[model samples]
Target: MFYISCTYKIMATFLYKCRDVGYDCGFEFSAHSRDDLMPRIRIHSRYAHNIYEMTDEMKKKVEEAIKQID
Candidate 1:
């Protein structure tokens, strides 16, 4: 009860657009955290686009592409 009362709203949404990454994939994903969003994006990238691997720089690019929504 105390914890709940003390809790503040966390606005931690992440947004990614496939087109922003120069793809016609037309896919977008949103989640509360990067950890929550990456797995789904990885699976989608692999199965849908045959993108099997993401380099550290590519991961950084993806992270850069993410937008925060309040």
Candidate 2:
């Protein structure tokens, strides 16, 4: 479609990191493909935002680990 043509590409943003809680948690910021909004991440209520976005050093560390995987 016209919109698709206009968009060259979209950068993925790991909206959050899922860790230090009851279960493994967090998100990875990998660009979305044609059929996906976030190609490599899944949304969860706990994460809220990418762990990297967090100001806390410890939390950021968690996010960094996720990034390394990508």
Candidate 3:
């Protein structure tokens, strides 16, 4: 007799929308994890919105705005 095992992986897509953070801009970003999405958001905030630094409040807002979809 022989036995076999199979494994499956599910990936969650993390999404962030600028509007969710009170921005009127229609910028949307998606990544596999928050770690990956934040850097891109930081760059966009600096270049597009002239946000040189992310305040603790802003970081909390951003984190709350992130949505995860599987």
Candidate 4:
């Protein structure tokens, strides 16, 4: 008799909402990983909100607002 084993990996989607970060705009982003989501958020912040540079406090707020969806 022979036996085989397989493994499956599930990717969790990361979500960020502009409203979560105190923005009235209804902007939402989702990515398979946090690494990918952040760049998009930064770009949006720069162009839409005129946030050329994100301060440490803003960074913390953004981090706190990110959610992981399975």
Best by TM-score: 3
Runs in model 3 lying further than 4 Å from the true structure: 1-7
Better of 3 and 4 by lDDT: 3
TM-score list, all predictions: 0.78, 0.24, 0.88, 0.87
Once fitted onto the true fold, the runs of candidate 4 whose alpha carbons sit more than 4 angstroms away are 1-7
**Worst ten in a row by lDDT for model 1:** 1-10
**Pairs in clash, predicted candidate 2:** 14-29, 15-49, 15-50, 16-49, 16-50, 17-26, 18-25, 18-26
Number of backbone-clashing residue pairs for each candidate, in the order shown: 0, 8, 0, 0
lDDT of 1 at 57: 79
Q: In terms of TM-score, which candidate is stronger, 1 or 2? A: 1
Tell me the lDDT of candidate 1: 0.84
Better of 2 and 4 by lDDT: 4
> Which candidate gets the maximum lDDT versus the true structure?
3
lDDT of 1 by residue, 1-70 (tens): 3554476888789898877777787899999997888898889879988989998877888888788887
- Arrange candidates by lDDT, highest first: which order? 3, 4, 1, 2
Which runs in model 2 stand beyond 4 Å of their true positions? 1-7, 20-56, 66-70
Roughly what TM-score does model 1 have, to 2 decimal places? 0.78
lDDT of 4 at 18: 93
Question: Pairs clashing in candidate 4?
Answer: none
lDDT of 2 by residue, 28-61 (tens): 3432332242223334423454433334654445
